[model samples]
Target: MYSAEIILEQRTRALSEINLNGFGQRHQGKVRDFYSLPGNRRLLVTTDRQSAFDRILGQIPFKGQVLNQLSQFWFEQSSDILPNHMLSVPDPNVMLAREAQMFPVEIVVRGYMTGVTDTSIWTMYQKGSRQMYGYNFKDGMYKNQPLATPIITPTTHAELGGHDKPLSRTEIIESGLVAEEIYTQIEEKALALFARGQELCGKGGLILVDTKYEFGLIDGQVAITDEVHTPDSSRFWIASTYESRLGQGQEPENFDKELLRLWMRSKGFGGDGAPPALDEDIIARLSQRYIGCYERITGREFESDLTQPVAERIKANLEGLAL
Candidate 1:
């Protein structure tokens, strides 16, 4: 894996190199640029640009490397659990992945109910109704506390300028977006994967608080695709201070993008209009956080020369793939 610094510099340079017209920017997600590839595949490129509270912020040096490498690490470790669309790591920020009929929803599995979004769900529950999408929360004697069991809540993946709403299992099945049998398989696979991730994070002195999974059908086979269990796809908290922080009502130390999100929210941006520039100190600190997570989670230090241009390194990786 490339060092965090090298990854970030390369992502920045790659984004700068993109002409943004030739490939027909298929979709511009918060921090990723997707381009259609030949033979039913796509090139997903991570940008150093950060997004918080839904707003895209200034690019952070090496942020893209952290995201991509972390995802690659998990993909390699968890391939036994399910198949993924990963074709090649052509570049530090670029992934050549199999293009599938992407499910229109994001499968979110919550192990703990302590996030801001979870809190929103709880508040809605207290009103004697669970509100997800347009559906009312199921009626039952319920406590607005952490679930003894984690729940799978799926949300639609909306396009820019569109609202993404939640969908129940029945709704997902009835809508014909995905067959019932396939959805069940995805749920089972997702839960098993999340369980394994939690176990691994626990060993690494971190908690896999929650994560989102995406699925796609490839040649009639449903498979887990996209980034899995990365700092971007999941929230991880330091396990050591978790109990103490929970006791004091203080937020636990997290290893995910929440820090950047919190910072962006503090700047009064929430995915609307242009985001403010982040200062050098914040960027440096965030870079350290990414590297720290990689070291702690993998128990391996990231090694790469940051002084070298990322393009050369990426070109080398691609050439190695050709061999």
Candidate 2:
């Protein structure tokens, strides 16, 4: 791991984008840049661009490598529960994955009534709506409190620069977004994945609070796609400090991107308009946090290859794959 000073110096050096020629048709998502590859596969290059509430905030040094590697870790750990699009990781920040027809709505499994985003279970619960995501919420639930059981709240995938809207199981099926039978299988697999994640995270003294799971049809069968249990796609908290802090009505120590979201919220920005420029200090801190998340969750040390520029390294590493 690099020191704080090195991380701060790398703020401007973070990789925000990398477009390779001859990589076939390219599609840009919030964080990952996808390009069609041979053998009906896709090359997913995770970038350092930070995003929340469906908005790109900024970039953090080494953020791409952390997210890509962490996702690769969980994908291997939970392959028995469900297959993912991951095929190989030739580069620390890139993944060669099987192409799948992605389902339009993402399945969110929440073990807690938390989050500040518009689609958060807590946000909707606070709005005085008892019916949410096809589940009825009774009164007396406190912020950040764990629910009796985890719930699956589906949300539509927003276009670039568009806000995400929440959906229920009934709504998803009724809209023809997904068939009833396949959707049920997706839901069951999603819960199983969450349980696996929670079991592993519990051993590490972290709580896998909630996470968003996306699925796609691979060979006409359901498969987890995009990233899984990555800090960018999930919420985590320190378990030891959770009950104590919540008893005092304080927020738990965040171990995921929620820390950054909370910071963005403090800056008076949610998901609307342009986000303020990320300061050097915050960028460095977020970078450190990303590295820490990788270490804590995977039980591995976070290391960066500082031999060359990030973009140059990635380009060279991918050149062989283009052959």
lDDT of 2 by residue, 192-211 (tens): 99999999888878999999
- Candidate 2 has what TM-score? 0.94
Candidate 2 residue spans exceeding 4 A from truth = 268-274
**Highest lDDT scorer:** 2
- Looking at model 1, the pairs that clash are 8-62, 54-271, 55-271, 130-137
What would the per-residue lDDT of candidate 1 be over residues 80-133, giving only the tens digit for each residue? 888888887877777888898888888988776455653345545655555653
Clashes of 2: 0
Error of 1 at 35 (Å): 3.1
* Model 2 CA lDDT for position 132: 91
- Alpha carbon deviation, residue 189, candidate 2 (Å): 0.5
Alpha carbon deviation, residue 65, candidate 2 (Å) = 0.4
